[model samples]
Target: MLKSMTGFGSATQEANGLTVTAEVKTLNSKFLDIYCRLPRVYSDKEVELRNLLTQRLERGKVELSLNVTRLTDIRPGVTVNRPLVEAYVNDLRNTSQSLLLDVSDSDLFKLALQQPNAFNSEVSTASETAASDWEHIQLTALEAIRKCDEFRQQEGHGLESKFREYIQIIADRLTLIEVQDVKRIPAVRERVRNLVTELMGSDEFDQNRFEQELIYYIEKFDISEEKVRLKNHLSYFLEVLAAEEANGKKLNFIAQEIGREINTIGSKANDASIQRLVVQMKDELEKIKEQTLNVI
Candidate 1:
């Protein structure tokens, strides 16, 4: 089954006064490469997210992002250290008296409390509401991933159909090449006889030597073996396409082999008719190669 490597999906949810949104994007790649942008609270979940993506998408560059927002009333309020504020106030008043720096002042106490570190707090901690909020976030994220996978599958189906059509085109061209090849034997034999007659010129050529030399020349240019291997490669290519596996790279390699064989046949064929047929066959195979780029 062929699957294209481009798709998108997103899911969002709000519950327990927290909002979570997730989106995933995929692009063509030789291997599964997953990247993530996640909230600090959910950073620990990156590995699980990667695994989930790898399991669903056999190969691609994937990006998954999770964003979390806290509602105002549910957030953790600020913290103030009353003991520390009091100590600062006492120390400042004593220092002022010892140094005779400042006159008595009630407003000074308020100024001391306003200093830095007098208060500290994490504004986003969920505390009692953390689990419920996390649950909603997780559910939404999973839904988004599922939708993305569905999109990939549908796109894959379209690519699969195209691959099948290209494979058929290659098979049909192979038939033409085989037919042309069969006609080549008779043509080569006739040409060999004429060449012998011309070269002998008034003296009969030795039949045994002529036969041996002719055999050697024909064997040197024969493309029968290459054609046989190409046909076999095409058959296996179709077989792998039918199987439920990640066979994109394997199919590409097979396609290279097919191209190699076609090249050998093109170069070896010397007849004008066969050369024209080879051109047509090459055109068809090139189309297959172009379409194979989308396989995943």
Candidate 2:
């Protein structure tokens, strides 16, 4: 089975008065590249989360975001620094007195709270609660990855079908080339004979020499080997596509080989009809190459 590198997945779970949502989106890339957005409290887990993504996804430009929201009425743990607030208020009162301006108590208190570290966030004391929350986040992330894989699998099916179609079209063109090739050789021989006779201005061309020259010329244009190699490459491509493991890079390499054979055949075809078929093969191969980028 083949897999596509493009996919999207997301999961959400609520536990311990916290709602965690994980989202993962991926696009085709030659290597694994991960970008993560984690809440500040969970920032320390970024490396672990990255490793998890690497283990699951072999290759892609991956974007992962984790959103932690407090669902309950209770806010995150925070406590006011009473001493800091009192000092700030004293400073504000002195400044107001010097400026001969009146300051409301509520306004002073609000301004004091806006200063840095005016409040401290209390770390959770319950180890089990923290552990459970982390576990929930991990599970949510794994579920998102699982869904992404499923998306890739579904897209892979479509890609497989497209590949089969393109390969078949190229195969059909190769068949047409073979049909035209049969007529090409004899026609080329006759044309060469006529041209030689015309140049000599008589039917005095040496039979032995002419035969030798014709044999060499025909050998140069012989695409039999190229045709066979191309067929084999095409067949091998289909075989790899049907394999159990994902092999996008291998398939790309095979596509290059297939292109090489097609180009060789085109350069040596010599026949207009065969050249046209070669052009069609090139077009189909280009499509295959484009689609192969999304394969895994």
Best by lDDT: 2
Candidate 2 lDDT, 1-296, residue by residue in tens = 89999999999988778888999999999899999999999999999999999999889999999998877665456789899989998999889989999889899899999998899767774555677889999999999999998999999999999999999999999999999989998987787778667646756767787777778777778999999999999999999999998578999999999999999998888888888899999999999899889886
User: RMSD to the native, candidate 1?
Assistant: 5.5
All-Cα superposition RMSD per candidate: 5.5, 7.8
Residue clash pairs of candidate 1: none
Q: Which residue pairs does candidate 2 place in steric collision?
A: none
Candidate 1 lDDT at 17 equals: 68
* TM-score versus the correct structure, for each prediction: 0.74, 0.78
